[model samples]
Target chain A: MNERDALRALAADLPHAGDDAAVVDDTVITTDMLHERTDFPPGTSRYTAGWRAVGASLSDVAAMGAAATAAVVAVYADADFDEADLDRFVAGAVDVCDAVDAAYVGGDLDTHAEFTTASTAIGTLTDAGPVTRSGAAPGDALCVTGEWGRSAAALRLFDRGRDDAAADADAIGTVDASNGAVERANELFRFTPRVADGLALAPHATAMMDSSDGLARSLHQLGEASEVGFELDRDTLPVHPAVEAVTDDPAERFELAAHFGEDFELVCTVPESAVDRVASDCPGTLVRVGSAVAAEDGITVDGDPLPDRGYTHGTE
Target chain B: MNERDALRALAADLPHAGDDAAVVDDTVITTDMLHERTDFPPGTSRYTAGWRAVGASLSDVAAMGAAATAAVVAVYADADFDEADLDRFVAGAVDVCDAVDAAYVGGDLDTHAEFTTASTAIGTLTDAGPVTRSGAAPGDALCVTGEWGRSAAALRLFDRGRDDAAADADAIGTVDASNGAVERANELFRFTPRVADGLALAPHATAMMDSSDGLARSLHQLGEASEVGFELDRDTLPVHPAVEAVTDDPAERFELAAHFGEDFELVCTVPESAVDRVASDCPGTLVRVGSAVAAEDGITVDGDPLPDRGYTHGTE
Candidate 1:
């Protein structure tokens, strides 16, 4: 069975299993695991890996519309792993936590054959209760924070770098060579989780979740949880400049922006009357992408069915 | 560098690093990572692996003298791992949480080359403040909850089982042929973390920590953290029956009980006036094996210096 099926079996025992983070009292907690083979690419730096891994869990906290409090990352690496890499990893982890005004609390470490990390983030509810994915209703405006496709663009660059290295040892030519594609890839990989925006949207958004699993899949998840469908305007979805540099085809850019995961942006449903207020109050970019509709209407983008596809772990 | 050295380096970035769990306001949180090669033996069942892995983090919560509220475990295993094993693992994880009155919240899963798990646990402080390791006083009694060397004995049994299997096909004789040694080993491996005892001792204990790294090492750690010395009475050390069954030599028994790790017992310091009260109040067996003394005195057992050795991850 795949991770989803395993999670379904576990859900019977976990009453608070569906949300991005488990809410206990006024606190939100979540965990995420990432491995070297599936997560980090050949040219990825240890710092970027640490930032991306810990940031993923922090994004879960943001999805709960809570104030990021603290995070811990348990590192598992080979016995002979370089000390510099470990230090760099911790430095990146600390910086990410500092960026979000959260503490980089300590965690455990163990020896393993492969490099792996598991991060857990804690957050606190603001004046408003948590904005769960189950709270959306028909007629709510669908919104996404910031642009997408940055990670997808980074992956494309990494693939090209690998191919170039294979062709010639020193021909490690960068994607968009003038811009230093390796540096750009790492920059794209490191994302600041939308914690401030989450807190700002808590008081206004009806339902919210992060688009770490691609916009299309996130919409499907929200639809399933909230029992509502969405009608997205293809023109309104913000595509990152990185995607444009990687591909000229509008369809390819749209696919990368909408279906490729790891955007780390908040996707929420807000009352149409409160949409303008939320946009103004948010600390980051918030764009109106669609409107929540009755479940019978079905989820669609430009009047066409949106494919349910995104990053998933294990074989399905 | 070893895990301890890495931790020392990281301590600079993490102000709240040295404790078993990082305390944020009234909450205590901690994470632990365990891999198959370094942690589990050849015959360890998936259920036991899950129980022991999650239990390690719960023990950290117990050491903080907090009420365990919830736990989450991220499982990373080969893609082709058995579904039945995954189900049993979750069942064990859920049951362990239930035993401690904590909710088994959800977690993430991913594919890895080897079986690995990372678990995080959350707990809340009681009416009394958190009992940290740095609070021990010179006159306090150094006590331990339950017995020691259960896990050590289990390890011995596992080693013998491996040897037996190699000796002759289908031989697999039990350690104590009549007692079903393999079954006993697994039972011994599954020790309940001292959560209840920790709570009971919290109101009275001056300092607290878990003895997962053996009693001798735990005393040294508490001494270092609290800046105190210990004078342990070797005769007073409570050795588990499992240890005695594994070895007939008194020296071997003492070595296993004092130096071997993974017992998951509470090593705490209580005031001289409250020792009797604490022993009676604790839900589990509480043994007064030593007393805190001036730092100049140094740590000793039976007038001899005790070696500070136990289960340490990575080479030290």
Candidate 2:
């Protein structure tokens, strides 16, 4: 099974797992993984493992209206687990932890045969009310903080083939995930999570979650979680310059912007009354992606249903 | 290199690794892998992956003087990740987790080309004090909790080896690790980390650790950490009934007892003044294994040189 199947399988077994993070009852949302590009092949400027693990988990916590606090980690490393790698991974985490004003606290490590990393992050909310996927009220305004498509671009530059044509095309066009089409793909991989944005909108937004799986998948998941459907205007959706210039296909460009996930951006539904409040309070621009409509549960573009392929994690 | 060599080499780099657990600054220590019967191939029965992973990580946590709080897991399986196997594994973990009282909160599952089980556990101490192996003061009473040599016997029986020995060996046997050996071994594999013991000893034991790498290697490590040496009396050690039944070869038996590691027991030292307190508080029986005597920087057995396999961790 790929990451998606793996997640679903685990979900099947764990009924209490919350949509935004791994919620086992109340008070925790976990997002832990060893991401690609950044951790290994040192000279490469990928995301660090510590950041990947903690940052991802941070997004999960933020999705649920919680303040970040502490974490513990276990790393099974090879003989090659040198100081430099740790300095990068842990140093990056330390920077983020400091930036967030949290503590590195405690964890453990041992040498295993392969590269294995396990981290359990814990935090507390002032109130224990879990902001689940089931909270969107019909007719709520669907707003997202920050732009999408950059992270997908960055992964391409780092892992996939990076051709200039793709980058150059996307540079002038709108909504191209094509490498050359998106000149700033590299910036996406280093995209800081929307924790600040999440915190600001937490109170006003009826329901929210970080868009790790692409825009469509995230929206679709929100719809599924809240049991409500929303309409996304293809024209009104905010597409990064990276999205337009980086790809050749206009429809795919839109899909990549919508369906391509790992954005770590927030998609939330706010009351019309709270919209201006959130836009004013949130650090980044709060773009109107769509509205939490009265429909059953699915997304529509130009009155037609959009196909979904928001990145699905697979077994490697 | 095999798992042992890999762990040894990795352990070598950790000059500041073990104080209480395998964490130094920010206090971090990590993983251990568990495979099923098919995984060991040559050795099956009376063991399960879930039990092994929990036990292994727990012991390491015990070494760190931290109580396990949560666990994150990554599982790699083929079609054989069956209901029965999963049920057994989950059940076993539930039993151990409840016994340990550590919550099984969150984890991820990824399918694999090979069958692999991995658990990343996080633990913490109430006080922020770090208990390192290097803290053993000369004249410290070298001590261990509970008995030894049960796991070896369990493994022998589980292996169902080619030797047409006269006994069921692990369960019935007359030497090395048998009876309590394999059972203890399985217990080590299935042992909940004695976090309570580690915590109790944290304030009093000058130098402390969970005995996973066996006694010899741990002794060397303790000496290395403390920058001192000691004498271990073979006769004074706490040998289990199964262990005594095994081999008459003191050196070989000791090798399996001390250097074979994975005993998951505790090897700690108390000051002469605090010895009584330690003896009374430990969850397992506290026995005088040796003493921090005057020596260059390694453990001695009855004043004679003892061969040490040390602690090895890694994939075979």
Candidate 3:
């Protein structure tokens, strides 16, 4: 079977009413997620690629409400892969681990016939209170650590071969390069959404997750786990400054940000009483963008169903 | 500016490392070592590949006198790779997690232009005391958990490319394609070094490591970490039945067992005082294979310096 079918088969055994595929060790613990085109690609910069490599695992820790502490990176370098390319890739890995305050612990490396990188990150979560996908409850307000949609924009830029849109200021220049495409791409790829906001809201939030997929997809996941629907205010959806500043069409930018993948930010649910406290704390904003509803309503945006459904790793 | 060179430059921040190296976490944690050519490959039976993937990671937890509690699998897949391979791989990983009693808490999967896989397994020390790579004092008696030569024999079979021999007994009988060479090649690829035995012995072993690289190379690592030299009794080596069955040259077979890569058993150093306990309680014999001596001698075999050096990743 192709990878998507395989993923669907495998997803049957994952944390959705399946066995909790988690290891509980004192020295190192790991949760493994397999992503294909859904996560990242070849020829991506050291930064985004590395972020995709590490941020996924770290988000697992954050979703579980644990402080990310360390990581071990394992990658499959192709036959024709350069030694330098491997080094840069690893450096990118180390950079992300450092960014998250995690160390690159021990790991094994080998050459494979295909180009794949799998990372296992170990973190110190001794104080965590067992955050999981199964913890969200009804009546909790749906919130996210930061805005979304930049990664998709970046992917579009990448698709069009807009290589020079590395920085935001020049991003506009590159946006003008592909008829304003770079502006769309630059804003998405560069966002690191770890949600220092989540930690502040942790005491108040019922359940949380990092939105690597689109906001709709993540909300759906939350709904599936919590057995509740969600209603989001389309107007309340926070848009990034660069996304708005670079692109004239606010609605287009907002739409992209809402459903774009790879933001790596937290989609959390808190008690309505604690929203003010969450808003007051956190380096990233704690915006109350939605509220949990009955499952029948499904998840909606501005009283209408979310279109384009969120990005799916294999099939979509 | 190859991958390795860039890695070294970027990892200039790492403390006291070698080129293409593995690091000790410096905590009371355990890790395992595996590579595509050795523990993971398409050559092993389809049923076992996924389990073996987890087994590769679990081997480390077994060595640390710890329980295989959680695992992080880092994978590098080629652009042309299929997701089915990943499914089988994850299947193996999940099976291994179950085997080790650890959860697969978190991992990262990225696509490279090349193929590679790395797994970092985190294990918890069973008791309050933690085992480390150090602690082998002079006069410590050397011990191993199980026989080593099977993987080497398997390697021989695989290298030969015999179809029937490559297939297990049932397969050989049915698919009688006499892949003598393939069978030989498959032999080493399919072996899972004894993790349970290693975990059982972790408490008493002064210094412990899996024979991941090979017996001789592992000894060198233990010696380096423990600041001690070793003397092995070549005649006392545990030659597997298969190696004896497959190879004509006794010395060569013994050498392969001693030096062949992918023998996942643990070769450990136990204080002379605990030698009896090791022998009685552990599955493998306490052959009193060697002694930890002053650094002057350095990793000796049969009371002499090693003739052929041990395995080093990316280098001969």
Candidate 4:
């Protein structure tokens, strides 16, 4: 079982669990962790790490269509963790909270074998209540905010140890360098959470969840939760331009579009009548990805079975 | 600068970065972290670790006189982290929340290089608002719930590698074992947060904070926040019997009483006239160890300077 499975099993005995965040009437509470080894690649600044950590959790709040109110972070670092880096980390955390219009309240710090950040974001739900992952109906139009495959392409660049070259390329405003792939990937690494988009589409959404896990995995989860399937249009999948710039394999880019996660984009199902409204209302470009189908139909892309290519923590 | 200093400095830049927890209107939010290397000693069961991690954060909510509604935990453990141990940890966390009349709503889990737990507790303020650490007035009676010197004494036994012997002693109800010190300390390590006592004292407390840091440090903090010093009566400090049993020297036991942290007991200031009422109303023994004094009076016990020997994270 994965971390999510273990959490589900443990949560079965508790009063609440399994949601993006635990909702207590009006409050939406969620947490996310970022470990240095798993999350930060070379050239990943403390500010980026801090922002990503806090933003990762806030993404859940946004997925719930809630307005974030405040956040508290718990940071564990090595004994030798630098004070300047710590300050930058906190600065990043504060900056992200400000971006979301939430207060960065107090948090705790401790020494550990390595650096780990666990952040909790608290938000208040609107009159529409929370937009859960289990509300999609058979006829609803499936959609996602923003493009895909950037984080996966960025990961490829990092794995090739070209992250520094990418940073240098961006610094010098040279996009056509030999290290252009890295530069393009780095831009994706700094993707922001689509909070405003989520808030905008929440009123019309039938179901919603962030594409933190790969889109394929998110679709599978949503299908399982709502007892429905999906028919995604491969031609309509909004693959990021950087994905093509980073790799020449059209099939590989499509796989990344389907399975690569950490996009922090809202994937929601809305009535067909409201699809255009959702697309127009959201801050980011809203792609008409697919439509929900009967559970027996299974999940598919362009009339073909969608492969299981999404990320699962503790599995990779 | 250390983690605390870093947090303090970062907090100075934010709108809400201080206080036991971030208070948003009537809600009280607090976070705390526990690491295996520094928090759990030898023979420390997963159950204890889970309970302590959740209890530590809840103690802060109680300090604020808030009614705890729910809690969320984030657990990071090695890839080889045992499934059964994880279950026990969750069970312990659930049990502690039950003890405090709060729900363990949900949490996140991930694989890490080592074991670390970061928990946040949510509570609602009472009619008394928050009993902060900055409300003490001169001439008020400074009191604490329960006894002290147990955790420090327990650490000594753990350092001696007699924790197992202590558990065995407890299992068989044998207090007079050769390693009696460990047994005594073990009992102390299993302490419950004084939630009831804190709730009872909130209405009357002029100022309050948990003695997670040694009593001396807590006093200095409360003094700094409230602009008042203290005059502690050495004879009145309710030093745990285990302290005397663990160490023969009176001065050494006294030092432990003054400087040993993680007691999870409320140290509060109440008007001198309400001292008896507080003592009679609290669930635990109300030890009148001192009285709030003018800022220049300085914090002292028996007219002698108390040594700064309490626990500080990232120190060792």
In terms of DockQ, which candidate is strongest?
Answer: 1
Looking at model 4, residue A24 earns an lDDT score of 82
State in Å the error of residue B117, model 1.
Answer: 1.1
- Lowest summed lDDT over 10 consecutive residues: which window, candidate 3 chain A? A16-25
* Tens digits of lDDT, candidate 4, A1-316: 4777677766776656787788887888888887776676654567777788888888899999998887888887777777787788888888888888887886877877767889998888889888998999999999988889878777776555453444565544323334544444445677777778888887999999988888988898899889999999998888888788668998999888788787788888999999998789887788888899998999998898886567765455
Measured over all alpha carbons after superposition, the RMSD of each candidate to the real structure, in angstroms, is 2.7, 6.7, 5.6, 4.3
**Model 4: per-residue lDDT, tens digit, B134-164?**
9999999999988888787787765554534
DockQ each: 0.65, 0.23, 0.32, 0.61
State which candidate has the highest lDDT: 1
lDDT of 2 at A17: 61
lDDT of 3 by residue, A198-234 (tens): 4565566777777767787788777887888889988
TM-score of chain A of 2: 0.80
**lDDT digits (tens) for residues A93-123 of candidate 2:** 5555555555554344444445645555554
Pairs with steric clashes in candidate 1: none
Model 3 ranges off by over 4 Å: A1-5, A11-43, A78-91, A112-115, A124-128, A135-138, A156-195, A314-316, B1-12, B15-43, B72-95, B104-117, B126-130, B158-196, B308-316
Question: What are the candidates' interface root-mean-square deviations?
Answer: 1.6, 5.6, 5.8, 1.8
Clash pairs for candidate 4: none
Model 1 segments more than 4 A misplaced: A163-168, A171-179, A314-316, B163-179
* Docking level of model 1: medium
Model 1: lDDT of residue A296: 94
List the lowest-lDDT window of 10 residues for candidate 4 chain A: A171-180
Assess every candidate by TM-score.
Answer: 0.95, 0.78, 0.81, 0.90
The digit string of per-residue lDDT tens for model 1 on A103-183 reads 888877777777888999999998798889998999999999999999899988887666766566555552333335667
Q: Which candidate number would show the highest TM-score if scored against the true structure?
A: 1
